[model samples]
Target: MPTREEVIEALEAARKKLLTEDAKKEFKGWNRTIQYYFTDSDEYWHFKVEDGIPGELINTEAEDAEIQFKMKEDTLIGLIDGSINGMRAFTMGKIKVKASLKDISKLQKLV
Candidate 1:
């Protein structure tokens, strides 16, 4: 169980990864509202990616998020920190995602 601060820190790292030059090219012209819902803490965090650049992490939900992730705090942190694999986690029932297959694949770019 990660604390809120830990989750935020992990998200900050993910945000930085999204801003890298390689990521920029890969995500070119992609824009979406991504939401994270931690089942353990009942906490929500979201961020908007515009033109491949991710903005600040907002500690609230996005009513119109294009992709939504639901998981435990540890799972969220693990995915962001590379300690856990997203696809494996999804297969193992550790994470739940609500998005189109395209968006789900795009998420592989972030986590």
Candidate 2:
């Protein structure tokens, strides 16, 4: 298990990685606001993707978030680090996502 700071650092890293041009091109035209809540630490990270890439990352909740996800810190870290598959984790009940079908479908590739 990672400490809270370590998990946050990983998320920051992921946010940077997600903003790269190559990453953005992969999910072009999919714009959405996302909220991630780490259950273990009770921390929230809110961000948005516009025109297919990550926009800004902030340490507060977004009132208009189009998608919300919840999971353990370690699990989130694993997902970001590629140690855990998003689909597998979601199916296994390790993570929970709240969003409309369209948004969820588009977010699949982004994750």
lDDT digits (tens) for residues 9-64 of candidate 2: 87787667666676777768878888888888788898888877787778987888
What TM-score does model 1 achieve against the real structure? Answer: 0.91
Which pairs clash (backbone N, Cα, C closer than 3 Å) in model 1? none
Worst 10 residues of 1 by lDDT: 102-111
Regions more than 4 Å wrong, model 2 = none
For each candidate, what TM-score against the reference?
A: 0.91, 0.80
- C-alpha lDDT of candidate 1 relative to the true structure: 0.87
Predicted structure with the largest TM-score when compared to the true one: 1
Give lDDT: candidate 2, residue 103.
78
lDDT of 2: 0.81
Model 2 lDDT at residue 98: 92
Clashes of 2: 0
